[model samples]
Target: MTTRLNPYLGFKDNAREAMTFYQTVFGGELALSTFGEFQASEDPAEKEKIMHGMLTTDSGLVLMGADTPNSMSYTPGDNYSVSLSGEDEGELRGFWEKLSGSGTVTVPLERAPWGDTFGMCTDGFGVAWLVNIAGAQQQEAQP
Candidate 1:
């Protein structure tokens, strides 16, 4: 298989639910593994928590999520952001509607300084996202 980069989300305790929700929005296949299944957690309470979850969409979007292990620390911060960018306004806007529906829209989708329609939002799961609809200049520069 070829190498690829994808977003890996870290959740405090809702990895399974969050991943399932993403599957519904993106129309994908979701696979989940619990700490108990992997024998990776010593805490009984955390045994059933998600150790790993992956969602692969038909549009070739791969999203991974996992619950923070009992031994690890989880802090919500501006650590990372998942970015979606393309010239397909309709498709991208469709995603924005679903993703930002119940989430917080820090920046409404609109024209940006670089001329693209851009926005930033934090999903219901507290995941930050950046969506950009490429402008004329960007589309022209693409091969």
Candidate 2:
């Protein structure tokens, strides 16, 4: 395997639901492992909780998530955002629409100061996202 950067999200107990929703949005193959499935926890309450969930899309997107064990603290914040950027406007816009559908759009998708169509939103699960659609001129200028 080659070096790759994949986003891993931590949820209190909704990792399964959140990851499922992502599969609907991104059209990917999702694999989930429960705590009990791997004997990862002795607590019955966490037995069914997701220990790890990964969604791998045909478009080369890999997103992972897991439920936070009761022994650890989970904090959702605005310190970070997952970004999607490319020259495919239609594909990127489709993602933005679904992601911001039941959530909040912090920035409307439009022409940005940098010349790309950009927007930011928080998904229903409270994960922040940034999408940028590269402009035609910008794409042509790139080598």
Model 1 agreement with the true structure over 102-129: per-residue lDDT tens digits: 7999889997655788887889999877
**Highest lDDT: which candidate?**
2
Clashes of 2: 0
lDDT of model 1 at position 48: 91
lDDT of 2 at 92: 81
Could you tell me which residue pairs clash in candidate 1?
Answer: none
lDDT of each residue in 1-143, candidate 2, tens digit only: 22234576778889899999999999989999898886768899999999768799999998877888898656785334576766766778888999999799988998865567889788999987778777774567679
* Distance from true location, Cα of 4 in model 1, Å: 1.5
Report the Cα RMSD per candidate. Answer: 12.4, 12.7
For model 1, the local distance difference test gives 0.79
